[model samples]
Target: MKLITKFVLLYLVVTIIVLGIGGFVSYHIIKGELDNELKWRFLDRVERVTYLLEQGKNFESPVQDNDDTNLKIVALPNRVEPNVEIRDTLVWHDRLQQMEHNLKLVAHRNVDGTSYRITTYGALVESDDITEAVIQILLWILGLQVIGAVGVGFIVSNRLFKPFRKTLERIKNFRLQDKNPITAEETSVAEFDDLNKFVEQMTSKAITDYKNLKEFAENASHELQTPLSIIKGKLELLTETDLSPEQYQLVEDSQRSVKKLSRLSESLALLTKIENHEFTGTEEVNLSELIKDSIQSFDEFITLNGLTVEADVEDDVFVHMHPVLADILWTNLFQNAIKHNVEEGNIDISLNSQRLRISNTGNPLSSTPEELFRRFKKDNVNSKSIGLGLAIIKRIADQYHYTISYTCEDGWHTVTINLQN
Candidate 1:
């Protein structure tokens, strides 16, 4: 749940608890006051009736009273003891001719040598009226509380979270390599301001480190090229000189070693450039055409190995990528398939709307195809292969946010690259 929603729900729960307690206390207070008033009215009526009897009023005619209250006088054999008694009980009211639950108060007194008792009854308090009044009042208070709480909560939440939302947007759009990177935005909230300052410092440091590393790779690649060329030339000249068989073999081996070293250096430089995103210019390229051209370029190598090729490339499978990088990616994948395959093996290349797959029949691998993507990883120790081909393919695919996967079973290695439209 959102923070604002949780806050509102918490506020509502507290309000309900307080209102419940308030309602309980108020109902009892009002009921108590009403009970006391009813008792006092009963007692007052009894006193007035006794006074009228003492005044020697004649009792020849029937007396009438309000339906809710009654007064009666009775005579006894002797003077009655003077006392007051009250009880809640059922009494038959003569005027209404029905039984009623009332507060009955009786007073006994003597006047003119006659014993007489005066009784007064008041109707029971209406419980439903009291409940209805309390409910109405509580409901009004509850309704007002809900409206005010929601309004105030919305205003406070919006103000409180504004800085956080702005910070999130800045982070989302921040780019490390951009000339103008994101900076910490000033905020009234101290914690939010501190967070922004920390993020800005971290991103700046990371960009500075990346630039230093990229510059070093470029300088190192340039510095090594001339030395490697000189060494290869000297080794080639030595191979042509008159010498013993052992010396000639050593010179030939040295030449081959120099060539391998040069290729390894070039591969490392290319990998670094790809990582640094140096190939940023992009254009629309027909991927099917590119694949066919790559396969044709390798026709001599494929013929030398006696490999059978099966290509099922669809028409107009287009992609957006740097022209040079696109060619390098396809070249690496095709070379990897041919370089690792067995003599007289078969290569199957399939392409459609979703993905590209290159499956080649090769000697069963002791290790899985996943290890082929690591630098200097070679399945055959005797083969003069610089093992950075798969690694380069992976880097290029990653740059495009494409998915590349490898699966090998039964001497058939399948490399898949999911193409994006």
Candidate 2:
């Protein structure tokens, strides 16, 4: 069950149990009190009748004189006779006939010929009526109380959870590279307020760690690049020193290894920077113009590689994104196409509102499209390009909340970037 339902069910169960116990106790107590009062009234009437008989008064006259609505009188003749046993005669007068009473009577002859017996009973008029009224009143009150409790519960629960809902929404919408921390005001409930504080702390810590890591990687890559360049230059100069063929081959191999290392380090540094959200200068950029520029820049490379370039882009397609990052994205994609394409292959670039797609005819990737975005994932065997190119584009798209996808058909590979609103 949902949280609210569980809460409401538990609350109602407790309330009902308490109310049931209270109502049961109250009903019995009130009934007992009413019964006691009826018994006392009956006993008091018995005493009055006995007193009147002791005074040698006529029972009928006393019954007539006593106007008690719940009282009655009776007289019975002596049963014993001088010769043999004789039957007794009994007479009774219900003075208050209209008054409803549950009566109990006992008769016994006195020593004298005149005899009387007292009777006791309760007035039935008030007990049932009063009990019904009490029950009705209690039920009405309980109904109102239950309604109020549910209403109050809903209001209180919603208010208490309001901060949690807001915190969840903030986290969902949060951008790691945006560098904006959660700074909402505290909630009324202490637990929720504390939770919000904890989330803020976590986000802040994550952002700090990301920045530090990216900075370390970028600095290390820069430092390595300088030494690798120096080594490559020195190796070129060493070719003038008259080395053996074997030595020359060793030098060339070492130079190639250094060049590969340099390229790998550069790609790693770029990937880290992109993931860290270092590209921040953004404006409304014309994507159509960017695509045209990319094609122009890669024109000579395309021709030299015997690749046909096709651009089917709409004009003035604008989007809000970092211009430098966008340029890098297009450049890497275009380069990947040229590098991986077969001789005399075709490259098609298309753009429309909020979408840019690049497809190139090349060898089918060995890996699935889903794995293509992962670091160090290379599809072409002879390609010197590090696998971080697509990964960098993916990170850029993620930082900007854009959507990117890859598709492969026959020998053609397609990459699409969907710009976010």
Candidate 3:
């Protein structure tokens, strides 16, 4: 979840819990106060009736001030001890034809040895009034909370987090080779300022380290090429001199080894250059034309190996890319399929607007296809492959944000490259 969303949700939850507790407690407190007030009113009415009776007033149907309050006098069956009792009771209402809830206060006393029951009642109206008032109050509180929480949570938080968001965007756009430093708008928030500073420092250090590594790789590769060439030349000269059969075989093997080493060094240098994004310039190139040309160039090799080549290419599958890299990518893919196939194997090439697929009849891969994309990983260990072809292909695909995958089924190995728009 986003920071603003989480903060608002948490605030709302806490506010609800607090309001629920406060409302519950307030409800009970108001109810208690109303109960006490009702009881005292009933008690006072009972005292007035007692006083009237002691004054020798004749017993009659006593007057009721309101339907909610009543006074009644009843004769006891026998002389009872003097006492007072108060409780809640339900009285039937003649007019309403329903039970009316009331608080009944009764006083039992003897006057001249005559038993009399004097009772007073009061309706429980305070509870209903208090409840209605409390509900209205809670509604107001809830409305205010909704407004305050949403408005303050969204508006204030968005303003407060703006600096952090900008800082994060700058950090995400930071590139190791780019010389620009990460920056954001100045803010009063100290933490965001500190974060931007840290990000700038870190990116600067990363760019410096990357430059050092790239320069070293380029210099080392350039420096090794001259010595390798000199060694090959010397070996070629040595081969021409008079020598025994065994020595000649040895020299040939040495020459072959030197050639392999030279290829490996060149591949490594090319891989380094690809990673450093040295091939930044791009042009419109027709991939279909390139594939046909590559096929024609490899005709001799294919014929000598007794391999059959098939091409099902669409017309004018154009792409914008570095011309050299595109050539390398297609060459490596074609060579990979050819070099790994069996004798008299069939190579099928299919190309359309969206994808290019190359399938070759070959021995079942000893290693998984996923591992073949790692540097120096090969399916056929007995083959004379330096094992960097698929690795180079994968790096180029990644550079263009394209997808490449391999699959093997029924002695057929397929390499698919998905060209994205």
Per-residue alpha-carbon lDDT of candidate 1 for residues 385-421, written as tens digits (9 for 90 to 100): 9888989999899999999999988879999999962
C-alpha root-mean-square deviation, candidate 2: 9.0
Candidate no. 1 TM-score: 0.69
Best-to-worst lDDT order: 3, 1, 2
TM-scores, all models, native as reference: 0.69, 0.63, 0.85
Q: Is candidate 1 or candidate 2 better by lDDT?
A: 1
Of the candidates numbered 2 and 3, which has the greater lDDT value?
3
**Candidate 2 runs further than 4 Å off:** 1-215, 240-250, 380-383
Backbone clashes in each candidate structure, one number apiece? 0, 0, 0
Evaluate residue 356 in candidate 3 and report its C-alpha lDDT on the 0 to 100 scale.
87
Tens-place lDDT per residue, model 3, 230-325, is 989999999889999999999998888888888898899999989888887889989999999999999999999899999999999988889999
Best by lDDT: 3
* Worst 10-residue lDDT window, candidate 2: 81-90
